[model samples]
Target: MSVQPMLKVERLTKTYAAAHGPLTVLKEVSFALAAGESLAIVGPSGSGKTTLLGLCAGLDQPSTGEVVLAGESLGRLGEDDRARVRNRHVGFVFQNFQLVPTLTALENVLVPLELRGEGGAAAEKDAGELLNRVGLGERFDHYPVQLSGGEQQRVALARAFINRPKILFCDEPTGNLDGDTAAAMANLIFGLNRERGTTLVLVTHDLALAGRCQRMLKLRSGAAIDGEPETLAGAARGR
Candidate 1:
């Protein structure tokens, strides 16, 4: 039997009501990603890349069409239900390293499980192990303020995977880091993604970073211009 795509969105459009009139952000963008697949959405600012990512992850509603993620149709679900779906199956890494300033790295990583009413020594241990895996084991007790940009992002990465999400959604995950730090973050992301068998959907402006994905979907003027499947190489396969 054929496997179902981990994520599928079709004819998606997001329109906002502006003082001028209706503003359409995405126009009929469609794509599907199989389990264990990776896709990059690359575009210029105001091209609706972040908007589309929010829509795909059930963080925002679309103006028209459907988003079927892991077989759950988002448009049909209530906001609470959508949030549940996100909390259960989706992981996120953002450009700003959205870690809580007051929480230690370990506590931050435990937030997701805690939200699920899950916590204990086992969850704590798992969180610690993930931090170790991401090269932040020693920084567990440190707050976000104490860590460098790259280190903070690493903590975010560990937290994202704490739930063992079926899919990961990254928005400019390397946008803030230096060249070497960006490359290192990319390596960690793809490496952990591969090791955990999680589907990756990345939004980036970096062409070289975009090239790492199995496929590319470029958006221009609020529309998708899908590219042929990429020939994965270089930084894509680690190093």
Candidate 2:
């Protein structure tokens, strides 16, 4: 039997009302991601890549269409219920790291598990393991302010994986890193996906990073366009 998609988006659309009237950011976008698959959405700034990610992760509601994550329809859930679904099955890595300034790296990594009522020594142990995996083992006691951009991002990555989420969504995860560091981070992400069979949805401007994904969808004028084979090849070659 064929496996079902971990995420399914049908005719998704989003609109914003500005002084100029209405602005449509996403236009009937549709796609499906199979379990353990990785896909990248590539687009220029303001092209709605981030908007699409937000809608898919239920962080924002679409003006039309439906988003089903792990078989749960986000359109049917209220805001609170949508949040619950996200906490249960979705993990996010943002471009800015989004670590708590007051918390130490280890504590930041532990926050998600704690929110899920998975606290105590066991959770700490797991958090530590995740931090170590991200090469931040020695910086566990350091606060976000004390770490470099790359280090803080690693901490965020660790936190995102703390729950072993079925689907992980990342937006410009390596945007702030240098080229070498970005490559390392990409390797780590791919390694985790391979090891845990987690589905990945990444929004990126980096052609090299996008190339590593199994599929690439380019966004233009609030819609996804199929990337040509040569485009994929060029991305794979880090052009």
Pick out the ten consecutive residues of candidate 2 with the lowest summed lDDT: 227-236
What stretches of model 2 exceed 4 Å from their correct place?
227-239
> What TM-score do all the candidates reach, one by one?
0.95, 0.94
| TM-score, cand. 1 | 0.95
Q: Highest TM-score: which candidate?
A: 1
Model 1 per-residue lDDT at 123:
99
Please give the CA lDDT of all the candidate structures.
0.91, 0.88
Q: Residue pairs in steric clash, candidate 1?
A: none
lDDT of 1: 0.91
Clashes in each model (backbone N, CA, C under 3 Å)? 0, 0
| Tens digits of lDDT, candidate 2, 1-239 | 97778999998899999999999999888889888878899888988999999999999999999999999999999999998898889889999999999999999998888888888999999899999999998998999999988888889989999999999999999999998888888888888877889999999998778888877878898987753312244432331
Q: Over the stretch 4-116, how does candidate 1's per-residue lDDT look in tens digits?
A: 88999999999999999999989998888899888888889999999999999999999999999989999999999999999999999999989999899999999999999
